[model samples]
Target: MTDKTLRSVTIERTGAGHFTATNARGGEIRFGTSSDPDGGADFTPVELLLAAIGGCTAADVDVATGRHSEPTGFTVTVTGDKISDELGNRMTDLAVTFSVAFPDGELGDRARAILPRAVKTSHDRLCTVSRTVEIGTPVTATVADA
Candidate 1:
């Protein structure tokens, strides 16, 4: 039996450094290795990774805080340094920063009060993407046999 918790996406190459990922629900996203978003208009693998990290935690934090009060503004920024070393190319010094604003009132005050704790909870355990990266999960690559 397949694991109930298993989630996956199928990636198909469309061209050099370009690909499409289709999820089980048939949602598709196009991405490429191009560094210029304005020129190529595609997200690089590293950028995708950063987006995943931020998006995951953002979802978690949103669920926790939105129930209390909707924010006037919310943003999450994920940043990292890419370096090639003896360990090969990888990201380091990763950081996630949140800029949020709530209205002036009791509900907003409550949301502001819990914002820090909500972010902490997401980073500590709620965000699977960030948690997996933090835990250094192994990735296995294989080619299909003809």
Candidate 2:
């Protein structure tokens, strides 16, 4: 038997190219189409995807480094390139850059030393979002008549 945790989200159209997505926990987010005819005031799907990946890895790195020293500041920038193929447009290469600051001293030294390993650990296994993307998890869709 396999241990599995089920997660689900529901999305409903709000307006032209605008939608609201709600999770089982009752959390909700609004999003819109990325292209012209501008959808809504919220993040687009691709932007949200980048945020998820960045946020996941950032959390993992923060916790790992916290054992040595709590970072005084931290920020992550994620970027990707859109490419075209027979399948249409999709993000091709993605990059994540983390900027972290620590208190100056031995603690800072230790934190710096641990940074690379922490990032590697997150990308290799810890971050659920990035790992899912890297592994190409299968997604199945079903349609029901209304």
Clashing pairs in 1: none
* Predicted candidate 2 versus true structure: per-residue lDDT over 40-106, tens digit per residue: 3588899899999999999999998898998999999999987889989889789999999999899
Model 1, residue 84: displacement in angstroms? 0.5
Residues 1-146 of candidate 1 have per-residue lDDT tens digits of 37798899999999988999999999998999889656588888899999999999999999989998999999999999999999999999999999999999999999999999999999998899999999999999888894
lDDT of each: 0.94, 0.90
lDDT of 1: 0.94
Span of ten consecutive residues with least summed lDDT in model 2: 33-42
Clashes of each: 0, 0
Estimated TM-score per prediction?
0.95, 0.88
**Distance from true position, residue 90, model 2, in Å?**
1.3
Error of 2 at 3 (Å): 8.8
Best candidate, lDDT:
1
